[model samples]
Target chain A: MFRQSLAVTLINLKSIPQRPGMSIATIISVALVVGVLLGFSAMANGFRATVQGTGSQDVAIFLRSGAQAELNSGLSRDEVRLIEEAPGLARDSGGEAIASAELYVIVDGTKRSSGTDANIPLRGVGEDAALLRQNFELVEGRMFAPGSNDLVVGRSVQREFSGFEMGEEIRLGNNNWQIVGVFSTGGTVFDSEIWADLGVIQNLYNRGSGVQTVRARLENPDAIERVRAYAENEPRLNLDVQAEQAYYASQAGATSDLIMYLGWPLSIAMAIGAFAGAWNTLYSSVDRRTREIATLRAIGFSGFPAFVGTMAEALMLSAIGGLVGAAAVYLLFNGVSASTLGGSFTQIVFSFAVTPSAIIAGIVMALVIGFLGGLVPAIRAARVPILAVHAD
Target chain B: MTEDLRQDTLYQLDHVSKSYTRGKERVDIFTDLTMQIGRGEFIAIMGPSGSGKTTILNLLGGIDRPSAGEIAFKGQRIDNLGQGKLATWRAHNVGFIFQFYNLMPTLTAIENVELPLLLLKMSGKERRRRAETALDIVGIADRAGHKPRQLSGGQQQRVAIARAIVADPAVLMCDEPTGDLDRESANSVLETLQLLNTELGKTIVMVTHDPAAASFAKKELHLDKGRFVEREALA
Candidate 1:
């Protein structure tokens, strides 16, 4: 039976060279479907990669007890001081605890190229904050000087946001802050923000005697649980402590879920269109060869063999379409950079990754559609009356 | 009782009945029909429209089961056999030819002939050899590689004959075998049928309205409204 099916498959493949247009159309339709599906999947992958890549095992994020993100809550200046001075906290070269009192605010700004106005995150970091992230590097100009009205713009911020260039001054609530330098963290979510002094941002936002969040590095990475326990027991602070990576994970959920959900409809609709195209081609092939099919049955081919042959033709067509679609996706969308919001209330930029997994999925989908579309037509062909075999 | 008469008795039908349902009415096509044929016999069934002559060939070829009674080939009952077994029995024993040459357009004459042999577990080369032999017997071996579209009506009928005999079945059944041919083509097909009957000793059952076509056969069975009204043997 398998051998018979293989012979039928080969025969169908031979027919493709003669009808090049139909073959090309099938391939193009499949490619379009696969390409769209992979596009959305890549966006999700990029967002997850950006956020999950950000935090280290040693760092932790401190927020208010009921707040999910920094934008929704604030930690008082006294709580920041107390958390920084807590035991088990890592100390820098100057013997001060390695912690940063970070302030976050959404500042309305104009985007570059299109100049569309959007809200961009403005992060205020303490002196030790830069040292806490090992990947952060100044790509151009110098770092922002502490105690001055100076700021450092991330590379993505400089590219996407208007007036966010090195040495340029951008106004934040009537206070003018100079963009002293441009920096990048290679990957990770920090590559999409404007960083200034914590006190400057707190005063500008009128959040006196408080910071939006307190982030600190542990002396021993495994002491995260003890730190969480300690923060939970502190009756005065009412702080929420979590691993920094987990915090970024929460940031990734919203955009990732959206992209994944978008892929569902896109994949389904494309599969239906491609399936219909395949069904049209395969049904015609069966109908056109009605006499041939009857002749075969009359010549002693069992109904099973005849049916299998017809379906093999459809599957071969679909497989070809799947390959074409995968190739198109790889060529057009792989390594494409895109930006969206993250769980930490910050913008993240990453590339459209056409992973091997996505390609396999597309092929599977194509084959299934082919099977569904081809099986019924094949059966119909096999069941045609023997007298009608010669009617043609 | 004689050896010659016994050898001539290749098939027998006893008390056969067949009918079709048309709306609320029962259209009786054949009833209490009885028949007997000899090996090496070239027999023609002649009848007008609705005479059930073709229905007799269909039943004898195992393509359709009778509504009642028995059809026997070589003294064994066949009408009541299960469908699966009937198919296997048909494969080894019967060859059917239609008025229009039903060769697969996609296949060459040789491949068309080779189709019946596919049911047998033979190598492709063996099937091709047998197909060639069948075409050669039908006197059109040179046209084996030509597709059906490339062949004349007579040549196409010859290819159909080749396909019918490729499996070396014992009985050959043809329905309006020369109905779609010109005078010359029809004569050619009739000659081939005569040769198959005389030289191969095949038990042939042919249905035709054309008396000229029937004349090629050694015997004539006359049917009317589903009954075998008369039988005539020609020397």
Candidate 2:
């Protein structure tokens, strides 16, 4: 039976080249469906990777008790100091806790790509900011000097925004700042922001001794719960505490969730259309090979082999389509840089990530469509009467 | 019947009936028909259209079942077998030849001949060797690499014949094998059937309207209105 199926399947596949129009129709429809699905999935994966990669499990964020994000949160100087002095905080080599009281502000900037004004984040960090963020690296030039009106821009911001190069001056509020250096944080959300001295931004924004969030590194990963308990119970702090990883995970949820909710149904709808196209192609193929199939049965070949042969033809076509679609996505979209307004109302830059898992998922989806498309046609082929050879 | 005669009998049909439901009416194609066929004999069933000649061939090959009574092939009741079992029975015991030379167009002559051998458990090399031998026997070995469309009608029929006999079945059921062929091609096919019957000891039952084609068979039976009206011994 296995041999019979293999022979019949090979014969059916060979006939596909003779019916190029029908075969190409199936392949192209499946490719379009898989391509669209992979494109949107890669977008969501890249957004999630950029946002989530910005956070670390050992770092904890402190915000106002009801604030949903650091953008809307404000902590006074005393409250920030109280949280930094908490027992579970990790100290640096100088016996000072590795923590930063940071201010997040959205400022208008001209996009290099569109030449239109968009909100870009300006993050003000204290002297210990670089010490606290272990992933931060100065890629070019030097860091901003204290109280010097000097600003360092993220690598992505330097590439995507106007007037963000070294030695260039940009105005924020009533003050002018010099872009002194460029830094990268491993393709994270911080790569989309501008960094400056804490006192310089506080004086410009008029927020006097108040910052948006306080971030601290814990002595160990397990110390996160201790800090959370301390913040919730300590009256002087009056703050909400969460792991930096969880905070960024929550920040990424809105966009990724929207992509998933919209992309999945769109993919399913496209898959249904592809399935119908495949069904029509396979049905026409079976209709044309009716006599051939009946002859096989008449010559002592069973219906099972005929059914398997038809299905194998469809699956083989679908697998090819899947590979083509995945390759198209990888070539056209993978690692392509893009930006969108994030939960902080600031433009976040990311690249489309066509990961290996995404390609595998696309191929599996194509096979599923193929299976659904081929089922009824294969059954029709199997049930074809041997007397059909006598019909015409 | 003598013991020697009983030993040679391949099929015994007893009071067999076949009917079809066309629209709202039941049409009887064969009613209360009984027949016997012996081994190593080439028999031709001749009849007009709708005389149940092809119906008998379909029943003999297990492609169709009788509506009533018994059909015994080598003393095993086959009329009551289920579809799957009947398919298996046909795969192992019967070969069929159609009038149109129904070879898979995508397969070459040797591949088409290897179709039936695939149902058996054998290595691909063994199947190919046997298929080549069958093509050799049918005298189309030189055209083994050509597809059905690449060959002439006579050569295609020879390939179909090789496909049928590759499995070495118990009987060859040919339903109007020469009906679609020219006179020369029909004679060529008839000569091949004669060789299979006389030289290879294969029992063949062919249905044909051509008297010349039927004359090649050792025994000829005329069916009319679901019954055999006459029998002739061809010399």
Per-residue C-alpha lDDT of model 1 across residues A1-392, encoded as one tens digit per residue: 45444444454555555566766776677767777777777778777887788887788888998898888878887888878767778887888888998888887667664667666788889887787675989899887787788989888787777788777878877789888898888776787888888777877788786787888898877878888888777788787888788888877887788888989798889889888887777777777667666656555555676688777777777888788877877787777666666665455667777788878888888788788878888888668765455463
User: Which number leads on DockQ?
Assistant: 2
Deviating ranges (above 4 Å) for candidate 1:
A1-35, A108-115, A147-151, A158-180, A269-290, A344-346, A378-382, A385-387, B1-8, B135-156, B177-190, B209-222, B228-235
Candidate 1 global TM-score? 0.86
TM-score of chain B of each: 0.94, 0.96
Q: Least accurate stretch of 10 residues (summed lDDT) in model 2 chain A?
A: A126-135
List model 1 lDDT by residue over B1-235, tens digit each: 1113555477888888998889999888888766676677788899998788878888888877788879998898989887567767777888888888876666689977877776778898999889999999999999999988899989999999988988988889998989999988899899999988898888789999999899888888788776664456553
By lDDT, who's the top model here?
Answer: 2
True contacts kept of each: 0.22, 0.73
Top candidate on TM-score is: 2
Worst 10 residues of 1 chain A by lDDT: A2-11
